[model samples]
Target: MKNDTPKVFKSIFALFVVAIFMIGLFYAFVSMPKGWGVNVNNRVSRLYILKNVRTATRLLDSGKFFAKGMKPLRAEVPYKPIKFKKTANLEDGAANVVTSIVVDYRGFDTLGEVTVLFLAASGVMMLLFGKRVKPKRKKTEPSLIMYVGTRIAFAVIFLFGIYIFVHGHLTPGGGFPGGAVIASGILGLFLGRNGYTPNHAGLKVFESLSGIAFVIIGLIGLFSVKSFLANFLPTGIIGNLYSAGFISLIYIAIGMKVGSELAAVVDSMIGDTKEEWS
Candidate 1:
């Protein structure tokens, strides 16, 4: 006799996958896009606060202790700090203030950014890494309804994900947000159908290729300019998706890199094994 778990698990997964398709469809077709804006420009300035004392003679005269008490807060800043250098701006190539700042002035922050993406990918993969793998010949009884539905569902999901990342140049969603949407959709397939595994071979190709493209873009910058991610391409019109030139290209690569890796992880964790209900 065959195990009955695939029948039960398949129903659960089908519902889950359908739900993701609904959400992605709603976001892609119904929601309005928001305009791009940068964070507030923060600069250091001397702030003098005068407090009232009842008597002049009762005042504390120790400048050392007063400055010392607040020593930890002191930046020891230069007399003047330049807020704008005529180098890179969102107008220069990138649309995002955070990305421009992190990727340009402080590239170490971009390393941390990539590291965060890596962490998210790792956490997702880790969730199912410890589950028991199925025997090669284990019989599965997944429903045809769920299986066919998820196959179509994932196709919509993958396209929407690509749209999100591609339009990230002009709109609100970028690689991170887009990739997350894609992962959510991929997760649905895992939930809906047992034995219907995601295409790991294709996903691995996506991950590896996107990673190579990102590194090559950075290397291209290095070959020409002073830094690793220097802007060398023609700057298109400001605020246009295709206009930002290299910035748009870079974000798309990053989106592909992130979305594929995360999807692969989601696919892996959702196994075709039987789950015992409590």
Candidate 2:
């Protein structure tokens, strides 16, 4: 009863704090500036809403809002020194500006993101170490149907992943999504094949080599162009397979590194689980 008293008090206190927080949040939301809220009757507000609706309708009908020879919308005080869309292809040689930004203009940030992902994968393995205990029972083999289907699907999925990363400069997919897709294919193998296991040494080698290559490419840019991760190579023709200069190369490196790292993580996790069941 004494121990229960503290628990009850703690629960009540938590609920009270949550209630206070909710009230404050609601008050702040309601206290926002009047002009920010919907005003159907206001003349200026109606005109602004009608303008947005017309613009949206036009975009929906034409499948585009901006066209050649039309003046682009701009803020009274523009922030960027150079417009992004105007120079994206010229600067990075990528048809997809989003890819150009992710793999070229803001490449160092992407490198940091890759580092974080690698660390997370490594951390999972490290944290789960020494906790694996092999069971004293024999493991059963996977069904023939499952094994055959997985084998066929694995190749297709891996090829699709390769295609996504290879054409990232010209398409919607990039290194991160492509690597994740490749890792998913490896995971399918882990689940469907009874005796299949990823080669840890090979994954490590690939991961290390890819990471080193990315840094080396960045260093080359720094030395030759006075900028880290600068587009040192010729951009080539836009939308071509060989276009986008160093963007595709960096994305390839990132794809390899991420795919290997994630595959290693899945391997470690599945291996530990298999050991526990063994």
Which one wins on TM-score?
2
Which runs of model 1 end up more than 4 angstroms from their true locations? 1-91, 94-99, 102-108, 119-132, 135-143, 272-278
Clashing pairs in 1: 13-191, 13-192, 14-192
What TM-score does candidate 1 get on C-alpha atoms?
A: 0.57
Q: What TM-score does each of the candidates earn?
A: 0.57, 0.70
lDDT of 1 by residue, 23-92 (tens): 9988886555445342111221121101011111132343332454555332322222213322233324
Show how many residue pairs clash in every candidate, following the order shown: 3, 1
The candidate that wins on lDDT is 2
Model 2, residue 126: distance off in Å is 2.0
lDDT of 2 by residue, 171-265 (tens): 89989889999999999998786557777789999999999999999999999999898879987666678777888888889999989988988
List candidate 2 stretches off by more than 4 Å.
1-89, 130-140, 273-278
